[model samples]
Target chain A: MEPGYDLPAMIGMTEADVQTPALILDLDALEANIARMAAEARAMGVALRPHAKMHKSADIALMQIAAGAVGVCCQKVSEAEALVRAGVGDVLISNELRDGVKLARLARLAGRAQVAVCVDDAGGVAELAAAVAEAGTGVRVLVEVDVGAARCGVAPGAAAVPLAQAILAAPGLTFGGLQAYHGGAQHLRTEAERAGAIADVVGKVRQTLAALEAAGIAVPCVTGAGTGSFRHEGASGVYTEMQCGSYAFMDADYGRNLDAGGAWTSPFRNAMFMLAGVMSKTRPGHAVCDAGLKVMSMESGLPVSAREGVEYVGASDEHGTLADPGDVLRPGDRLRLIPGHCDPTVNLHDWYVGIRGGVVECLWPVTARGKHF
Target chain B: MEPGYDLPAMIGMTEADVQTPALILDLDALEANIARMAAEARAMGVALRPHAKMHKSADIALMQIAAGAVGVCCQKVSEAEALVRAGVGDVLISNELRDGVKLARLARLAGRAQVAVCVDDAGGVAELAAAVAEAGTGVRVLVEVDVGAARCGVAPGAAAVPLAQAILAAPGLTFGGLQAYHGGAQHLRTEAERAGAIADVVGKVRQTLAALEAAGIAVPCVTGAGTGSFRHEGASGVYTEMQCGSYAFMDADYGRNLDAGGAWTSPFRNAMFMLAGVMSKTRPGHAVCDAGLKVMSMESGLPVSAREGVEYVGASDEHGTLADPGDVLRPGDRLRLIPGHCDPTVNLHDWYVGIRGGVVECLWPVTARGKHF
Candidate 1:
């Protein structure tokens, strides 16, 4: 229904005039955030592979690449395909890929670009190799190492060796080094916690690197670090790359993290916002907004209202309750909500109404949205 | 990207052959659910206006209407617009709508078919009335009452009179009585709790009806109730129309609702499922699937694995952790997850792959998806 609808007709409207329940991107904040991150990565001598899973937009990936990022990282093959089709020549899927269908798509996508993927299981190597052979192209395989987050990936030391060896054994696969991402570190509240988490991960990476070198394999790359701990890992001599994605779009969860001085200051500015309208304010201090869980992600926590004197208390399917002090918000008043989590929250909208100088600069379709497969 | 990609190329394929992270609707379960709800509403003599927010699909609405439903109720104006475009007439937007943009679109929509909306604010009435007058059409405006939700509604009794009177005073607006939905009772867990909650709401509705009648305003309709507590409200005689959604697709939250003997048995079956692929199983007694928060709604709770020996323990952005006891699921094995909540979970996907006899029978686009505006 939206394909036929005039979704892009709001291109020239001002921020205040654009329709509510729209995903608004502050282009100035976005450019500043990107430039700062690129400068930091270049200074630290680490390649920046911003995760596409965060923005899920090919347009954002292009901007990052232009800002000196070494391609992008995706969590799914479909996302990689979208980026590749949109002319992103280099991509590293930070997550593991199995299942014949996805592997074949990844292999096909490799023909369009320099495609790489992470692996933790030996059985997955043969399937990926077979798909690559069918596609008549090769894919770089990074053996994922579990540094902290007890999620996908092999244990950080010698456990990843067998997977690396299997990738080397495959004819159409190139054994790229370790893919170690400590996802839990991205939400560490304090500087000490974020730094300590990355420090331990660096120690494990050292052990993994030594083990791989002893096995007569050259460890080419060690890519891992998120928005919360990327600075820590960027300074580490052992790390080769920082996969910071959320730095491009600061969320409420990341905003909660403390800096070195124990103050709430980050290098990045919050560029992503959900524009909602006040739909009801019948009660004295109570109000309801049009955006809710279907439009905003509430995993980390509820969105912090950008408006003063108003508090977002709760949300249902399509209604969000706001505790407005003395009814500050009436019907038709637009409110900006800083989402707690950017990745999934961005997934909720179809178009990002890019705003610059209070004017709608562009309307980029969230191209890779709903591409879970 | 999906329009070019063959997403439904697996139409005649079995469940194992279907793609990962797809919203699968079991045709058998769906038909049975529709029949059961239609039968129950018939027995109770309540007009069934199943909420389209649960499915957000006009195809499902047409099916409900075919099975003896008085059209459907939508929570958002865009949803109602899509359903009307698809030829499902008589839509009652069960939530309050403000803002000129939405009201104008809604007014335009009312010209296509029978459109009704709820109002809780007098200021909203002026704008809605302006839009209706411009459209040269009239709309049934139901004065929303705060029926224990603590969300978007005026107080039930005389407090609702001013809004009702305003709706009556507005030219091109027809006062359609009270929109009293006890949202809390939907998840009250016990039969007595749900029944008691609705019983209290009934008393409030009676008072509101008296107040409206005394003010010379005729309360034409009183529509409320959901799949969880629809039975209780339908029997309450005060509720003339039932807005029960989720009966077509029962989720884990509804599955947790207890029946007469405190056993987990609702008349409806668990039909809506997120078909996920086991993407990783590197650790013993643990596995990871391809579906997570991006695919299922975690608000009601995390999804439950349909497989007997496996359990979904946690989820991240793009992956869900499964505690597989006994080393059952391997990478590439597909499993269905019963989502915790049906409404927002359905909002996560773009297409619903309808399955019948272990084969993909149809693929319906979630047409109104991401239509929050």
Candidate 2:
């Protein structure tokens, strides 16, 4: 659905044309964020492969590419398919794949885009090799190294070399470099802690690179870094591609991260908000809004009211109760809520209704919103 | 999408023939549950209007109607629209509406089905009345009484009367009875606590009913109750409708509720499971699966491994890490995961692939999966 196409026209326009419980993206803030990240990557001479998992919209992926991003990284094969269908030429799935159906989907996707995937085990390599061999297509395989996340990925250093060799020995797989990512360290709260975490990651990457070199293998791409630790990874001279996703639409969680100046300056501004309306104000201190647990993700924390002197206290399936409204908030009052987390919150909506200057400027379908499989 | 369609045919089986991690519904268990609830409602001599919000599918609504349920209750206008499109004749949105666009949508939906909506304030009533008048359709408006949920709905007793009178005075709106639902009481750990909470709710509903009767306003339909306290509400002589959606696909959270035998017996059996394969298991004491926070909702809690001896501990975007997998997991091993919460977990998937007896049987597209509006 395009902007103003399937949606109901604004019945009565207000200061903000759309009603509450609407997903709103600040286009100016978003562009500035893309430019800032692109400039940082350009300065460091490292390729910026922005992760599309954060926004999950092809329109934003195109904007990132237009801003000189090398490619967009997708977490799921379906996401990669959606991006490729949207005309993204270069795509890399930074997550491991083992399902045969998904591998076949990836092989089909590789026909249209420069598709690469991460692998931490021999079984995954064998599966990818089989799929690629059957399709008679070349797919890049990156050996993911465990930096600190303790999730997927093999151990760094000597353990990663065998995985790389296995990928090179596979029938139709190309040996891409390491995916050394520490997801936990990205939200370390302080610059020193983030830098310390990244330093440890850089040491692991160095060890893996030395092991590959000793074995007479050229490591092509060492890609890893998020919006929180992209600068550290870029300055380390290890990673060739930085996969930062949240830099496009910063949320309240990112706003808490500190910068080098120690003045709590976020690299990006809060650009996404769920516009909700005050549906009922029967009580004196509380007013219920249309947005709730269904509308916003409550994993990080509850959404903070963007308006002054208002706070979100609780949420149900269909309604969010706001606390301590300074004035009597009648029904139809629009409120902008800054989500605690952006990624999961964006996944909850079907459309990203872009609002600029209070008019319905554009609407972009969240093509990968419910692509869980 | 139906059973034995697309993927199921490719897998060469019916829904009853698929392996575990595939969502399965025992026809016997489901029919027994429907019959049990209908018998309870018939014994109580009250209308059984089951809520469609639990299972956003119209197939379940049709079954509820066949089991002697008067109508189905919906949480959103979009859900009601989908239900009506799927042939549900009568529907009620159990939430307040303030947006004119949504109200217009509701009025349009009323044209196809017997539509009713809850109102908590005068502004909502006025907008709904105007929408109904403009659409040239009569919509039943229920005055929602805040029966301890502390969410939407007006204060009990006289405060609800004015809203009821306003609905009566509206051009194309009829005043339905009070909506006295206590959502918080549904999840009470003990039967005694749940019954006690329902008792308090009954008092409030009685006050509202008496006030309306004294004012000579007809209270045609008094609806409220969830799966947790439906039995108590059915016997209370106040609530005429039971809105229980999760009974169709019982989850781990619901399994915690104690049964009538003084033992831990789930009221509804576990029917839904997320089938995920072990993506990486080369590490000791840990194995990662393809299902994660994106695939399954973790808000209620992490999904429990259906097989004995395996425990789910950590999750990332596309991976669920299982710890202490005592000889039950390896790469290529498939496991069924019982989700912590059924609603949000169901919303994550695009298709509910139903498998039974070790074969892929059916694939139901989650038609209203991401319908947040």
Candidate 3:
């Protein structure tokens, strides 16, 4: 299968002239976000490993690496393969690798690049070690401690010891560190809630590290944190690397998070937008845009209109009904939508059209897109 | 961008040997669905124009066409382009075409196949007329009527006549009647609600046709309906064509609709399944699968596990938490998920692996996948 869109049609066109349902990236805002996160990480004396799973593009990953990122963190083996294929180094699979086919690919990638993966099961450790030995490659293994996400990873403290020891016992695997991503805390809304969540995560990390030390298991690094609570993790002295993904494309959901003063406190501006065209205005109350659930991620929530006053009301499979009260939009009129979640929304499109001053400056192929397996 | 998984890694592999996070299609179930729909349409004496937007695969479209379909209805011009490019002829853009680039491409496609598109505006009619004339091809026009969906289309009765007249006035265009799809009626829990919704749709369609006939416009065809309400529209005397998609890949949401007897009455069995592998079972209550929102469509609802007693609980970006109470499933166990909505779920993957007797039989590329423009 080939991606239908090879190159962008918005090269010489203005932002208004660009095609509908295109992923538009504001380079200025993106650069500002990259710089902001890098500066924050540097000040906190922690290495930044921006989550490549959020963007799924090596171009953005390279940009972050160029701006002082230690590496990129992916959730899938195929994602790691795609990023490494694009010449990125020091890639980490932040999630578990159990499928033999994927583990074999990860082993192959580990031979070429500095590859690391998280493991929560001691039983699966031997399986991964076999694949690593088959490929004649060394893979760094991280013992993932369940830090309140309740999704993946072992329980904190003593529960991580067996997994770390299993990795240490394996010939082709090195017991690297721990992955303590408090995923549920990322979007806790209030700064206190987010701070409290991270505080709990910090306590768990300390507990786990102390338990591992009691068992005479030396841990090198501890990686965890998303864009929503990266500040707390960066400030924590125990966290060595912060894995913030959506810092570059601060979406509507993250934009809704409040600070200590109860105001939206995202340091990043909206760098990502899904461009849609008003396809119909015949209806009295609402106008339909060409983009909807197929292109935009509605997991967090529906997209918000970039223009003020116009509200995104409803959506079908292929159309978004905008509540156009003043009839400001009509057929052929273009609009930008701030997606609720940037990662899944980015997964829907093939190219990210970078727009600056209403002109298309860069187009990056979502190289790892649709690499679900 | 080139697709990462260019071909099936499960050609000779058994169901157990197939890779994780793959789309597995039951060929027997799919064939049964196609035959059932075709039989239903034939018995009702209405032409079947299965909506290509659901599958977006030319291969499946060809199978649909081969199984006694008149043609296929696509929600986008780019989907039609990809389908027609793959040799499936007689394509209809079921949605409105207003964008110039898309319209021009649609016109160019009209020169190759029996092409038609929907239009609800007079201004867009003139624009499409220019493109159709430039391409020197006959493009049929369906004046979509707002038959209670409230999303797109001009109002029924007197409102749609002018648009139908506009299409007739344009050169290289033929008035292809009305597209009155009650998309909202498809998921009404009870059969009476669906029947009532279609009755209302039929009334509006009749009113619009009466207005068109009063203006001396002869209607050639009326296309509408989907997997849920196709029986209602097909039985309606006014509807000439049924645009039923998702029949071949019955999803969980569609499976929820009750029949006249208040039973799960879809003649189509669950043909489409999203295959996910158990990556972690370290947690006592729930196990995490490799597939989540990134691969599956959770908009309608969470996926139902195919195995008895196994329930889908929660999801993250890369992990789906499955509540495996009986411990029947563990790490490396493959589970089939009945997707919430098949269309968007199909949009996430690249290939569809056909399984028969628990053996890999057919592998079809989701050729038009991600043709969102």
Candidate 4:
């Protein structure tokens, strides 16, 4: 219950000396992911603004920047503020802001970093403008165009022009570019389907860019793309920036995506892992672990046991049931779990005990882990 | 963003001044829920050990204790630790523990409070005993019987008797009782199914209790039951404590459960609301809000708009789309969203901006919000 009992001290050694159900980050794998994405973006001549929404840790953002990412994209103003405070120079809030209090916070963030936000409405543009004006700061604005994800964003092409115009007209706000992120296309399992999805997205972005050009407006940055479809977006000339987030922590869901050769070849290595301890084996064919629905995200799917011969079958609020391996797993067995969805799963924890070379390197606070607003 | 800002600095202010996308806890409704549950427990003559996994807040646990609950059940050791540190006297960790580190933590927890834990294996009993012996504390251990959930817990009847005996045989661990909680039964939809599910659970408990009694072992407590079927467990004469977590904050999923009259009647009032603002209204039929999958949990389903004529149809990582309430919603319009799942949704926030009478009265830290150990 007293959380700060250093795991190393309690266990009489370092983190590497500890067993499973611990959140471990392969620094090498993480760096490789960052480098690969950066190289891809550099080759494609697109800005690489990695989404901080995926990690929510400033440490990761700094690493992304160091790997030549243009900037970081934050989903919430609070997240942006946290990143900026952590010395992230540029942050694009790839989501709209309506609350005046949040808008004011956005303006403050703009003072510290190169702040840009996405707007899908004329009123949102005006509000951003007003907040920027009130704070006496210059903030950039992007018109969010709905490509295929019918979740947010305005209709593509001409519809986005007016919002861009409003943002341009608003005092203290500059028309930054377009946010053409098709979130749904990112998880299309098959390569052809993913390509087709992004192809449609690219066509929509092209039309939007043409419409803006016709209106005598320049789109400086058309940012969109996730780890799953970054290749498609990178190939498409319309997308100026790729907003890939999950490439850092490749999960089982993303790992299912097929490559061009019709074989499963994940571009990124699995870097994130949840270490769990076997809590119970009172049953003959099952052993219960200490991680469950609350510890891991079951939205995408249940976590796959990293160890061979172990199958994760069920989860309760606090306990996860693992199918018994042929060998007996007693109460003290440690299990490593590769989360199905890394983003939300990370959100469920307070600290990321960063382990490297089997040692407790550091514990990074999930600073924006629960920043819903 | 720097979260603490204007927006009517006190609770019970007009809705116009409240911040959007803030967690609003209706104290009046919460008190009513506590009272109603307490009254029901009193009437049924069952000890109510409300689960802290729902709120994960010590303040709420204290409130439940004040409302005449015997103790509180937590899903994780970290949560139990937090509650015990906050002065929650009788704490039951309704989950298994495998690692010596957690067992040590649990043992330390027993020093301050009446600590009871569930075990489904002999190895778990040994670990608990070792930790308790090391700490020089007597920790109570409950043999978790697998009623029907098949998630955790050992098999009922004879299978549970050995685990019970193991706990009793342990050096520093005392045989507390049996845990026969069926989580999946909580959302059975109809009253009959819910009752049937509890009946099945009760049968399993009866068998296990009989097995223990036949072996000349006295089962001190038979704790089980949830918000969905506490009444059934209470009436079954098999359970001593009811661990219902969600009665404090009834959600859309719970709202689907039917009463004896075959009418959908939620036992508790909807006390938790996610106050979100319409960030975009460029389209005719849709309005985008700043709250989405990352803010609100979508595992159960989309959050239902409290206001009539508005539907939360979809969500992106950071934006929730509300079907436009024709001619009523603008870009800055504030809306209250009743999350589909209150527990996970609440876990996604750091501060519960408790508002009363439309004003922000208190900002309580979700103390164990991300305690995913």
Fnat value of model 1: 0.84
Where does model 2 sit among the CAPRI classes?
acceptable
lDDT of residue A348 for candidate 1:
87
DockQ per candidate: 0.68, 0.49, 0.62, 0.54
lDDT of 4 by residue, A15-123 (tens): 5345445577766788888898898899989889998988999999998999898899988887787778778899999888887888888897788889998888777
Would you estimate the TM-scores of all the predictions?
Answer: 0.97, 0.94, 0.98, 0.95
- lDDT, candidate 2, A11-75, per-residue tens: 32433547456778877788888999999999999999999998999899999999999888988
lDDT score for residue A345 of model 4: 84
lDDT of 3 by residue, B246-334 (tens): 88898999879998675554488999998889999886668889989898878899999998989999977778999988877778889
Off by over 4 Å in 4: A1-20, A263-265, A325-328, B1-13, B325-327
Candidate whose DockQ is highest? 1
Among residues 3 or more apart in sequence or in different chains, the pairs in candidate 1 whose N, CA or C atoms overlap within 3 Å are none
User: Mind giving the per-residue lDDT tens digits that candidate 4 earns over B275-294?
Assistant: 88877776677777877777
Tens-place lDDT per residue, model 2, B1-373, is 2222123222435432332223444445566677777887798887888877666777778988999998898877877887788889998888888776778888988888899999988888888888888889999889999999998888778887888889888889988888888888877878888889999999999998888888888898788987788888888877777777677677777777775566333546676777777777767788888777676667677888887889989877667889954656777677778888778776665566644555654556565666666
lDDT of 1 by residue, B1-373 (tens): 1223537326777888777888999999999999999999999998898989889998999999999998899987888888788889989998877766678888888889899999887787888999999888889999888888899888878888888889888999998888999787888888888888888988989989988888888887899998878877888888889998988998898888886796444588888899999889988899999999998879789998899989999999999999988999899999999999988989988889999998888888887898787
lDDT at A265, model 2? 37
Residue A163, candidate 1: Cα error in Å is 2.4
Query: Of the candidates numbered 1 and 2, which has the greater lDDT value?
Result: 1
Error of 2 at B296 (Å): 2.2
**lDDT of candidate 1 at residue B29, scale 0 to 100:** 92
Question: How high is the lDDT of residue B257 in model 3?
Answer: 91
Candidate 1 per-residue lDDT, tens place, A127-172, comes to: 8889999999999999888898888988878887777888888998
